[model samples]
Target: MPSLNVSFSDEEMEGVRAAAAAEGKSLKQYLHDLGVREMHRKRFVAGATAWADKLRGEFDEAFPEEIPPAQRGDGAAAA
Candidate 1:
Protein backbone atom coordinates (compact mmCIF):
# COMPACT_ATOMS: atom_id res chain seq x y z
CA MET A 1 0.00 0.00 0.00
CA PRO A 2 1.13 3.55 -0.73
CA SER A 3 1.16 6.32 1.87
CA LEU A 4 0.52 10.06 1.81
CA ASN A 5 2.10 12.53 4.24
CA VAL A 6 0.47 15.93 4.77
CA SER A 7 1.54 18.85 6.88
CA PHE A 8 -0.75 21.10 8.91
CA SER A 9 -0.36 23.91 11.44
CA ASP A 10 -1.07 23.13 15.08
CA GLU A 11 -4.45 24.88 14.94
CA GLU A 12 -5.48 23.02 11.84
CA MET A 13 -4.32 19.70 13.33
CA GLU A 14 -6.33 20.36 16.45
CA GLY A 15 -9.46 21.04 14.44
CA VAL A 16 -8.91 17.89 12.39
CA ARG A 17 -8.34 15.85 15.51
CA ALA A 18 -11.59 17.10 17.00
CA ALA A 19 -13.49 16.22 13.82
CA ALA A 20 -11.98 12.72 13.72
CA ALA A 21 -12.94 12.16 17.35
CA ALA A 22 -16.47 13.38 16.69
CA GLU A 23 -16.75 10.78 13.93
CA GLY A 24 -15.27 8.02 16.13
CA LYS A 25 -12.29 7.68 13.79
CA SER A 26 -8.61 8.27 14.11
CA LEU A 27 -7.25 11.20 12.07
CA LYS A 28 -5.75 8.86 9.46
CA GLN A 29 -8.97 6.89 9.01
CA TYR A 30 -11.02 10.07 8.71
CA LEU A 31 -8.71 11.43 6.03
CA HIS A 32 -8.68 8.14 4.15
CA ASP A 33 -12.46 7.94 4.16
CA LEU A 34 -12.67 11.54 2.96
CA GLY A 35 -10.44 10.71 0.00
CA VAL A 36 -12.51 7.63 -0.87
CA ARG A 37 -15.77 9.58 -0.67
CA GLU A 38 -14.39 12.31 -2.94
CA MET A 39 -13.34 9.74 -5.52
CA HIS A 40 -16.85 8.23 -5.54
CA ARG A 41 -18.44 11.67 -5.83
CA LYS A 42 -16.31 12.54 -8.86
CA ARG A 43 -17.18 9.25 -10.56
CA PHE A 44 -20.89 9.87 -9.94
CA VAL A 45 -20.67 13.35 -11.45
CA ALA A 46 -18.90 12.06 -14.53
CA GLY A 47 -21.48 9.33 -15.05
CA ALA A 48 -24.34 11.81 -14.63
CA THR A 49 -22.80 14.21 -17.13
CA ALA A 50 -22.42 11.47 -19.71
CA TRP A 51 -26.02 10.39 -19.21
CA ALA A 52 -27.27 13.96 -19.62
CA ASP A 53 -25.27 14.43 -22.80
CA LYS A 54 -26.77 11.25 -24.27
CA LEU A 55 -30.28 12.36 -23.28
CA ARG A 56 -29.76 15.76 -24.87
CA GLY A 57 -28.71 14.13 -28.14
CA GLU A 58 -31.74 11.83 -28.10
CA PHE A 59 -34.09 14.79 -27.33
CA ASP A 60 -32.73 16.74 -30.30
CA GLU A 61 -33.22 13.77 -32.61
CA ALA A 62 -36.79 13.20 -31.41
CA PHE A 63 -37.82 16.89 -31.60
CA PRO A 64 -35.87 18.30 -34.51
CA GLU A 65 -38.58 20.94 -35.21
CA GLU A 66 -38.57 22.41 -31.72
CA ILE A 67 -36.31 25.28 -30.69
CA PRO A 68 -34.39 24.64 -27.52
CA PRO A 69 -35.65 26.55 -24.48
CA ALA A 70 -32.55 28.73 -24.31
CA GLN A 71 -33.15 30.09 -27.81
CA ARG A 72 -36.84 31.04 -27.28
CA GLY A 73 -37.57 34.78 -27.57
CA ASP A 74 -39.63 34.73 -24.34
CA GLY A 75 -37.02 32.65 -22.46
CA ALA A 76 -39.78 30.29 -21.39
CA ALA A 77 -38.96 27.30 -19.25
CA ALA A 78 -39.13 23.88 -20.83
CA ALA A 79 -42.18 21.82 -19.84
Candidate 2:
Protein backbone atom coordinates (compact mmCIF):
# COMPACT_ATOMS: atom_id res chain seq x y z
CA MET A 1 0.00 0.00 0.00
CA PRO A 2 1.12 3.53 -0.69
CA SER A 3 1.86 5.83 2.26
CA LEU A 4 0.71 9.39 2.78
CA ASN A 5 2.50 12.11 4.72
CA VAL A 6 0.21 14.67 6.32
CA SER A 7 1.18 17.78 8.21
CA PHE A 8 -0.99 19.36 10.92
CA SER A 9 -0.54 22.05 13.53
CA ASP A 10 -0.14 20.95 17.16
CA GLU A 11 -3.74 21.82 18.02
CA GLU A 12 -5.08 20.03 14.97
CA MET A 13 -3.03 16.94 15.72
CA GLU A 14 -4.33 16.87 19.27
CA GLY A 15 -7.92 17.12 18.08
CA VAL A 16 -7.41 14.29 15.59
CA ARG A 17 -5.77 12.14 18.24
CA ALA A 18 -8.65 12.70 20.59
CA ALA A 19 -11.16 11.76 17.95
CA ALA A 20 -9.29 8.59 17.06
CA ALA A 21 -9.06 7.60 20.70
CA ALA A 22 -12.76 8.22 21.21
CA GLU A 23 -13.47 5.85 18.36
CA GLY A 24 -11.05 3.27 19.83
CA LYS A 25 -8.83 3.49 16.74
CA SER A 26 -5.34 4.62 16.00
CA LEU A 27 -4.99 7.83 14.06
CA LYS A 28 -3.97 5.97 10.90
CA GLN A 29 -6.93 3.60 11.12
CA TYR A 30 -9.41 6.42 11.63
CA LEU A 31 -8.23 8.31 8.58
CA HIS A 32 -8.16 5.14 6.49
CA ASP A 33 -11.72 4.29 7.47
CA LEU A 34 -12.90 7.77 6.44
CA GLY A 35 -11.36 7.34 2.99
CA VAL A 36 -12.98 3.95 2.57
CA ARG A 37 -16.40 5.25 3.58
CA GLU A 38 -16.17 8.12 1.11
CA MET A 39 -15.24 5.72 -1.67
CA HIS A 40 -18.25 3.52 -0.94
CA ARG A 41 -20.60 6.51 -0.82
CA LYS A 42 -19.48 7.66 -4.27
CA ARG A 43 -19.98 4.20 -5.71
CA PHE A 44 -23.48 3.94 -4.24
CA VAL A 45 -24.52 7.33 -5.66
CA ALA A 46 -23.21 6.45 -9.11
CA GLY A 47 -25.12 3.20 -9.17
CA ALA A 48 -28.33 4.88 -7.98
CA THR A 49 -28.06 7.58 -10.63
CA ALA A 50 -27.54 5.03 -13.41
CA TRP A 51 -30.52 2.98 -12.22
CA ALA A 52 -32.76 6.08 -12.10
CA ASP A 53 -31.81 7.07 -15.64
CA LYS A 54 -32.56 3.58 -16.90
CA LEU A 55 -35.93 3.52 -15.16
CA ARG A 56 -36.82 6.97 -16.54
CA GLY A 57 -36.03 5.80 -20.06
CA GLU A 58 -38.33 2.80 -19.63
CA PHE A 59 -41.11 5.01 -18.25
CA ASP A 60 -40.83 7.38 -21.19
CA GLU A 61 -40.97 4.52 -23.66
CA ALA A 62 -44.04 3.02 -22.01
CA PHE A 63 -45.89 6.34 -21.98
CA PRO A 64 -44.97 7.98 -25.25
CA GLU A 65 -47.69 10.63 -25.10
CA GLU A 66 -46.99 11.87 -21.58
CA ILE A 67 -45.23 15.25 -21.39
CA PRO A 68 -42.66 15.56 -18.65
CA PRO A 69 -43.71 17.96 -15.88
CA ALA A 70 -40.93 20.41 -16.65
CA GLN A 71 -42.20 20.97 -20.19
CA ARG A 72 -45.81 21.73 -19.10
CA GLY A 73 -46.77 25.39 -19.60
CA ASP A 74 -49.63 25.37 -17.05
CA GLY A 75 -47.25 25.83 -14.04
CA ALA A 76 -48.08 22.37 -12.76
CA ALA A 77 -44.40 21.77 -12.18
CA ALA A 78 -42.39 24.47 -10.45
CA ALA A 79 -38.93 25.21 -11.79
Candidate 3:
Protein backbone atom coordinates (compact mmCIF):
# COMPACT_ATOMS: atom_id res chain seq x y z
CA MET A 1 0.00 0.00 0.00
CA PRO A 2 1.08 3.61 -0.55
CA SER A 3 2.20 5.46 2.57
CA LEU A 4 1.44 8.98 3.78
CA ASN A 5 3.10 11.14 6.41
CA VAL A 6 0.80 11.80 9.35
CA SER A 7 1.43 13.73 12.54
CA PHE A 8 0.16 13.09 16.04
CA SER A 9 0.52 14.95 19.31
CA ASP A 10 2.50 13.41 22.16
CA GLU A 11 -0.63 12.41 24.04
CA GLU A 12 -2.18 10.89 20.96
CA MET A 13 1.01 8.97 20.19
CA GLU A 14 1.19 7.62 23.74
CA GLY A 15 -2.41 6.49 23.64
CA VAL A 16 -1.88 4.80 20.28
CA ARG A 17 1.24 3.09 21.61
CA ALA A 18 -0.64 1.84 24.65
CA ALA A 19 -3.41 0.46 22.50
CA ALA A 20 -0.93 -1.22 20.21
CA ALA A 21 0.95 -2.72 23.16
CA ALA A 22 -2.24 -4.13 24.64
CA GLU A 23 -3.15 -5.67 21.31
CA GLY A 24 0.42 -7.02 20.72
CA LYS A 25 0.77 -5.03 17.50
CA SER A 26 3.05 -2.35 16.25
CA LEU A 27 1.66 1.18 16.30
CA LYS A 28 1.18 1.22 12.54
CA GLN A 29 -0.79 -2.01 12.57
CA TYR A 30 -2.94 -0.83 15.46
CA LEU A 31 -3.74 2.46 13.73
CA HIS A 32 -4.48 0.61 10.50
CA ASP A 33 -7.01 -1.62 12.24
CA LEU A 34 -8.61 1.34 13.98
CA GLY A 35 -8.85 3.27 10.72
CA VAL A 36 -10.45 0.34 8.94
CA ARG A 37 -12.97 -0.13 11.76
CA GLU A 38 -13.96 3.53 11.62
CA MET A 39 -14.41 3.36 7.86
CA HIS A 40 -16.69 0.37 8.16
CA ARG A 41 -18.59 2.03 10.98
CA LYS A 42 -19.26 5.10 8.85
CA ARG A 43 -20.52 2.95 5.97
CA PHE A 44 -22.77 0.92 8.26
CA VAL A 45 -24.33 4.03 9.82
CA ALA A 46 -25.05 5.60 6.42
CA GLY A 47 -26.69 2.42 5.15
CA ALA A 48 -28.64 1.95 8.36
CA THR A 49 -30.02 5.48 8.28
CA ALA A 50 -31.22 5.13 4.69
CA TRP A 51 -32.84 1.76 5.41
CA ALA A 52 -34.48 3.08 8.58
CA ASP A 53 -36.13 5.99 6.79
CA LYS A 54 -37.57 3.61 4.18
CA LEU A 55 -38.78 0.71 6.39
CA ARG A 56 -39.55 2.44 9.66
CA GLY A 57 -43.24 2.92 8.89
CA GLU A 58 -43.75 -0.77 8.06
CA PHE A 59 -42.76 -1.75 11.58
CA ASP A 60 -45.62 0.23 13.16
CA GLU A 61 -48.26 -1.97 11.49
CA ALA A 62 -46.51 -5.22 12.45
CA PHE A 63 -46.32 -4.03 16.04
CA PRO A 64 -49.13 -1.59 16.68
CA GLU A 65 -49.14 0.39 19.92
CA GLU A 66 -51.49 2.56 21.98
CA ILE A 67 -54.17 2.43 19.27
CA PRO A 68 -57.62 0.84 19.23
CA PRO A 69 -58.48 -2.05 16.91
CA ALA A 70 -60.33 0.21 14.45
CA GLN A 71 -57.33 2.49 14.20
CA ARG A 72 -54.83 -0.28 13.52
CA GLY A 73 -55.82 -1.08 9.97
CA ASP A 74 -55.14 2.18 8.09
CA GLY A 75 -53.58 4.30 10.84
CA ALA A 76 -56.90 6.14 11.36
CA ALA A 77 -58.70 6.46 14.67
CA ALA A 78 -62.11 5.42 16.05
CA ALA A 79 -64.27 8.41 16.73
In model 2, the Cα lDDT at residue 65 comes to: 96
Cα lDDT of model 2 by residue, 1-79, tens digit: 8989999999999999999999999999998997899999999999998998879988899999988777878666554
Candidate 1 off by > 4 Å: 58-79
Clashing pairs in 1: none
TM for every model, in the order presented, reads 0.68, 0.61, 0.69
Instruction: Name the top TM-score candidate.
Output: 3
15 in model 1: Cα distance from truth in Å? Answer: 1.7
Rank order (by lDDT, best first): 1, 2, 3
Q: Over the stretch 21-70, how does candidate 1's per-residue lDDT look in tens digits?
A: 99999999999998999999999999998998879978888989989777
Compared with the true structure, model 1 gives a TM-score of: 0.68
Q: Each candidate's root-mean-square deviation in Å?
A: 4.7, 5.1, 8.9
Q: What TM-score should be assigned to candidate 3? A: 0.69
Top-lDDT candidate index: 1
**Residue 42's lDDT in candidate 3:** 100
RMSD of 3: 8.9
